[model samples]
Target: MASLAGCLTGEEESENTLEVLHGWTGGDGAEAADALFSAFEEEHSDVDLNNKPIGGGGNENLDQTVSTRLNSGDPPSAFAGWPGSNLEQYDGVLGDIQSDVWEEAGLEDAHVEEAVEACQFDDGYSAVPIGSHRMNDLFYNVGVLEDAGVDPESLDDVDALIDALGTIESETDATPLAMSLEAWAILQTWTVVMLSTQGYDAYMSFIEGDGDESAVRDTFETLEELLSNYINDDAASVGFTEVNQDIMSGDAAFIHEGNWVAGAYINEDLEYGEEWDAIRYPGTEDMYGLHIDSFIYPGDNPSPEATATFLRFAGGETAQVAFNQYKGSIPTRSDVSTEEFNDYLTETIEDFEAASEKPPTLAHGLAVDQSTQSSLEDVLNNNFADPFDVDAATAGFMDAI
Candidate 1:
């Protein structure tokens, strides 16, 4: 069987059409995929690209489909994913991207090095670093902050941010913080809070395939503090889409989410950098905003041509800027000019750079494999529900991992 690399390169019978698969289905997902495909078509007029977006609402179904396909000796030319420990699963279906081009693209050496080392299977570069979605960003309404007599930037620490949310809730009859109770959204939001307060060392240990009980316990304790202050009584009842609407309509004062919220705001024709702004979740000042998108090349099947083209384009500065701007993610290549990005994005980039200057906290999903990821999600779900038993939750989590 020809590898994805060979398929990408036209080594096999010219399948000029590149079939890119992802889990983005509707809403912002559709917008993001459309932006990338449109850019690809504009650039490579000769290549017919088919962006096969399979699932919606953070689709796990499509992820399963793609994984099943890859494991069954079939894989797309390139697939969207997050780079982390799980790249080990697809042992040899990636193509090696050239080192020189990577450097030339102005990808910070550390970012490239991390992706290469962590995402690599055995052969070479397992995946190209696409734009990153900072998971821990908190979006809030400026009026809400002003009405509460609080400075938006004052939320640099966890305790301060919680107090601010509480004050805002008390002063205005609005929900202080709005979040959907959906499993993934809850888990991702909590994961951000956990990573921020618990410190990168512990977060990285868990992400790097180590299950540190103390780290998990600390994270949970911090989450308990945060949940006590922020989450509203009706949290368990609302969906993410409704949560987004609440935030947009100013019914909720704050939302902890990824960069895509900006895109969602844009789609709603809501004013940004004025009505609202985004900040890295409180206490992440020393951490790089979490990087949440990955594209891995299969090593065993080796589609050198296709893989090369895909990696080159995926990592290139032009593609990075275009995709990220429309998708509302930070560009992977730091060299690209983000002048068009609003104040919130600029502030996020500044924070990310500062965090990088220290050390990085790997996204929890990246640090751990699928099994551990599932376990953590389950633990988080139970914790988010009632009867908040920290010990039982921690015990169940530690045992599962």
Candidate 2:
């Protein structure tokens, strides 16, 4: 693997460095991101690659780091991020990589239908879709649920879910549901709760800025109930990475997260259906919440050639397959085979195909602009999570979108 030229010492000026920024800083995510980076490095041996990972709840930490760099006029050659309406924030600053990366990767014919409009920006593509994640997934510890006498299938709606939470609390000592009160995670949970309560049309309408106040209030009320009584007492102090692992440790029974968290369950030596498993987040069975992560190509990128090469690899079958194998996601390319994927991802792939509708996820920049996402994050972090202030949080959410 060659060294990228984006950030270099005096001796490395001759090499072309492509500093690639991403959020897969720890655990299985780091391994998955490494697979993609290693494959790209092997294919483009002449270019130096600098890997920058900002770790936290998904993009919670990464977005701010990228924003700080962008404000300081130091954007990476390419950064891993979401596509779709989220790209609207960087409209003018992004380059048209359609000809170099998109055409070279032959993405038009090979990628999934959802990948088409998602990568579009300024008459060309802004990023390359490597993997697709279903955001509305609730992973549970098989043993904990069995001990609590809770059936995942019987819990179909928010009310049933809360009842199960109570049953788990009363029957066992484990935290009923694991949670991270980080702004992004809270906001993510809030959105899914919104989806669970109101259905697909209303959920879509909410992110599009046409949401009903009653729905917003209702979502917050549920959030308050769950966070207040069902979770661990230390939820606010713990981060996502820690709480997610609680299921495997028998400290928690359930966690609401995307498919990415499943990789950790496997890494813990847990089987798909026996030790741990995932279920459709209550009420989201009819819909697939798309969490698309791509690599953003900035217009003023320093290592243009390296960036193109990296993007080309990112869009290829090799990179996607290797990454998603450990990333707990499916390749965006429809032609990519999933024989190597584990049991969980195989089922996720099937669910994606059979789902009635797939909407962009709001919590991770899929459903709204940067301003709205940031605003909601601030609102949730400042007013909602700790206090569980339903009315204020509802008002803040409505104003943000």
Candidate 3:
């Protein structure tokens, strides 16, 4: 309820001082970003807020922008980001958010704890949790499942889920799953499979390894098997836009996507539970589809008032409701309800709550550090898109990082 607008004075108040640069171009991404800015404007009417959305198709890479700005001594007051061990990159540059504020906001649950731990740097400060969008969820057409004699709710294990896939494929001419060539999404699908099979320990060990030859070998082998078995018809060729279109129509029965898919469904005027429902991707009995997304406040930030205002407004209950509702993500605050979501979303929430005790495995995109991200991104794009020498690709990825 505290307004950052109050911290400013006279001439500067109406100056439209804060320019937020983010990658929230059209679609639900744009709507969600706009909603967040609207909330800020409502609270601080005098502050001139300029929203400069960067990139399209989720191409806005905040890490690149943040690095450029911080090095140039012109960092934004606040910027969008996710927390992982790589948060250590900020070191002295990132600020320690007020713990009392996060706690009072009711964001100290186990999931929040996991996110904080992932985001925390050596100094113990972290990028504050804003909202979470569950990626790697298997969203499917409920009607299609019924037609295939597959029980949408009966997919309790990986075998059963795979079997259901086959049934759907045989019964309908549509693609059983709609996946994209986007490196992040492809890598996410791989991570979900890896995490589901090996669990969190193996994943952590491999990532933490100093390019262990054997570990890298096993990971690549697994990747090959996954691409060959589950995916259909040159999946490596489809781009993000094409994949979403496949899902939007009845061309595809399922798509491994993040919560943002809900926006596409809403855009199509389709109702959840009736037309579609999302289930935790198979092989993830221990882990639910939980991913943390947030904003990191630079430690050396000169505009304390603006940064404080941004963080406060972001975590506030009002902002949580507005942003999450529009973004089709779960509110970071536990006290908030998902009443706005339809039956399918409620079911997804139920699954997330049930698996709350299980530590959320970091989606691969945000799990590894920056240096490692580029390397892995290269591997994903290469292995998925082209017929590369697997052994060379594996070694190259490990070496590149």
Which parts of model 3 are misplaced by more than 4 Å? 1-16, 57-60, 99-111, 122-126, 156-159, 210-226, 229-238, 299-302, 356-366, 388-390, 393-401
* Candidate achieving the largest TM-score: 2
| Candidate 1, position 247, lDDT | 78
- How good is model 3 by TM-score? 0.82
> Which number leads on lDDT?
2
Which residue pairs show collisions in model 3? 16-48, 93-299, 94-299, 95-299
Give the per-residue lDDT digits (tens) of candidate 2, residues 205-229.
8888899999889888988999988
Of the two candidates 2 and 3, the one with more favorable TM-score, higher being better, is: 2
Ranking by lDDT: 2, 1, 3
Please report, as a residue range, the 10-residue window in candidate 1 with the lowest summed lDDT. 356-365
Error of 1 at 133 (Å): 2.3
Stretches of candidate 1 off by over 4 Å are: 1-14, 92-118, 205-215, 232-234, 237-239, 267-269, 299-307, 356-364, 382-384
